[model samples]
Target: MQLVVARIGRAHGIKGEVTVEVRTDEPELRLAPGAVLATDPAAAGPLTVASGRVHSGRLLLRFDGVQDRTAAEALRNILLIADVDPDELPEGEDEYYDHQLVDLDVVTVDGVEVGRITEISHLPYQDLFVVERPDGTEVLVPFVERIVTEIDLDEQRAVIDPPPGLIDDRAEIASSRASREEA
Candidate 1:
């Protein structure tokens, strides 16, 4: 299987280095030197990583054939893909691949069916599961260990222990809290 690991951003300097919007949980392994990555447009690469570094908190990479800013600039917005084994799992027990979480059914601990995970939104600090409700509405559920209690692949389900107001309707949650406080 092939997984998208990063997107080529703007050319950094005149040194063939380009900024990357990293997509993988293990950038060190996926975007390392000598790593041959497939490109989105298919013409821009099969680029081999010559070198990589972190500059000003951003990931910068230089490809083997891309030796100048103009060449690197031409590859902008192209996605870099890495060939991965389907069975390959992350080193951490708590870690899960984005593909594994997407499409899982979501429910509360008490078994109230909430929705189905339609996408996994990967942000810099944290990841979120985009759940689509039966009514076609969507909610962004933070994929935190505290809130996302369990993931059962066999059942194709994810159990979440949502905080008060998280799963509840906005007006209902506020009104209920207000009434309780008044009493």
Candidate 2:
């Protein structure tokens, strides 16, 4: 499996050090020094990681042979992909690879069909599962233990216990309010 580990950002200094927007959970293993990564454009890499450092809370990397700011800047926005084993799993029981969750059916605790997992949005604080409903609408479900009650990989589904307005239309609230006013 080819997993995207990071996206190259701007050149940090006059050297060939570029900041990266890390995408994977295992950056230390995937983006470490001496690691070789493939690029999205297919021509920008196979780049080897010459060195890496943390600068102002961000990760900066110096790729072998990329010796200048212009060279590093040129690699900006390029995605770094690493070849991973299909059977390889993350080291945590509750953790999962993005690929494992994508395409899984989403359902309510009562077995109401909601949608299918379409994408995983990795935010700084939390992750979200982008689900595509049968009607073509999309919902963003926070990947939290409280909301996502269960992930049954064997059943290929995710069971959620969404708050009242989280899944249902908010217009239901408005309708009830209007009815009470009429009464």
**Which candidate tops TM-score?**
2
What lDDT score goes with residue 28 in model 2?
88
Q: Model 1: how large is the Cα RMSD against the reference? A: 3.2
What is the per-residue lDDT of model 1 for residues 89-166, given as tens digits with 9 covering 90 to 100? 878888888777779999999999999999777787888899998888888999999999999988999999999867
Query: Cα deviation of 77 in candidate 2 (Å)?
Result: 1.6
lDDT assessment of candidate 2: 0.92
Candidate 2: residue 129 lDDT (0-100): 93
Task: List runs of model 2 lying over 4 Å from the truth.
Answer: 169-183
Model 2: lowest-lDDT 10 consecutive positions: 164-173
Output the number of the lDDT-best candidate: 2
